[model samples]
Target: MPGERTKYAWRREILATRAQVSPAEHAVEAAALAASNTRLTGVDDVVCAYVPVRGEPGDLRMLDALREHGATVLLPVTGEPGPLSWARYEGPDSLRKARYGLLEPTTETLGPATVAEAATILVPALAVDRRGVRLGRGAGYYDRTLGAARADVRLIAVVRDNELVDRLPEEPHDRRMGWALTPDGGLRQLGRDLPVSPE
Candidate 1:
C-alpha cells in the first residue's frame, strides 16, 4: 500500500502518460481489444461495464461484444460522489455526455444495488497491479458502487498491456480486482482472491 500523496502522484503521472498516446495507437489498440475474446462472455448474466472517455482503452466495443455474445450489459449512470446508479446499455446511440467527462446512458436509472445482479464488472483503470490493486481516476465512484455488487462478481480492470504493473499504491477502501482486460492479452487473472469486506 502507498500513502495518499504517493497515490496522487501516481495518478498524475499515469494519466499524463495516457494522454500522450497518439490517436492512431488508440484506434489500433481499441480495435484489438474489441476483437480479443474473453472467455467471460456467453454467461447469460448481467455484466456491469463503463463507457470509456478520454484516452481510456476499449471503446463501446467491449459492451457491444458482451451484449452480442450473451450478457445483458449494464452501464453506469453517474450521480453525486457516492455509490453510482446504473442503466441498461442499448448502444452508443443512447449515450449522452454527462458530468465528469463520462458518456452515460439516457435510459432509466437503476439503483446501485442493481449491480448485485452482475456476474462480472469491467472497470476502467489507469493501471492495475499483479496483486489486483486498481488505480482509478480518483473519484472513488467504483469503490462506493462495488459494495453493492455481489461478492462473487468478477471485478476486472480494463487497461492497456503496459499499464499492468507489478504493484500499485493501494488503500484499504480501494476495491481489488480479480482479473484484468488488456488489448493484446485479452483476459489475464490478477490471481488475487482477497475477500471483499463491506465498505
Candidate 2:
C-alpha cells in the first residue's frame, strides 16, 4: 500500500506537471458538455463543490449543469477531522471564499443527513484508473463524506481525459469512482471492479 507521504508527493508532482485550462472557461464549457450527456440521469439532489481548477481540480461545470437541470446542489464545508458539513447552493452569488480558497455556499447549513439525499455525487479526484480506483489529493474528505451516501448512489469523478489512466497507486481508504467525466469524453463508467495492485 502507498503511504500517506508518498501519496502527497505523487499528487504534488502530478499537479505540478498537469496542463490546466482557465477555471472560469472550463467551468462554463464543462457544464454545457455534461448537461448534454445522456448518462447523467436521475440526479435530483446533488452534492458538489467548486474547487480551484488546474491548481486544484476540474471546474465546477458539473455543478452548474446540475443547477441548470433544476437539481438541488449542495457544497461541502470542512467540519471535524473526518466529516464534511453541507450547505444548499443557490448560485455563484451565494458563495463566499472559504478554507483552501474554495468557493462554498453560505446559505442554510445542512448536515450529513441532508447530503445523504443526493442521488448523485460529483467528487474531485487527482486521477482515476480504468478499474474505478480514485486518487484524490491525499485528503480523506470524500471518502468520509461518501459514507453517508446510499450504496446505489452514483459517485462520479470529474477529471481531465488524460487524468484517467490505466493504473495508479491505491490505498485502503481510497474510494472508487463509478464514472468519470471529461471535456472530450462525456461520461464513461469506470466499471465495478477494483484494479489489482502491481506486485
Global lDDT of each candidate:
0.83, 0.68
- List model 2 lDDT by residue over 1-199, tens digit each: 5343465676876686564556585566565455543346544646454444445444455566667776777788876667688887787788888776678788978776765777777788877888888888756788887887888887877777677887777778777888876666667778743322111
The list of candidate 1 runs beyond 4 A from truth reads: 1-5, 192-199
- Tell how far residue 170 is off in model 2, in angstroms: 1.5
Residue 100, model 2: lDDT of 66
TM-score: model 1 vs. ground truth: 0.90
The model with the greatest lDDT is 1
Candidate 2 pairs with clashing backbones: none
Clashing pairs in 1: none
For candidate 2, what is the TM-score?
Answer: 0.80
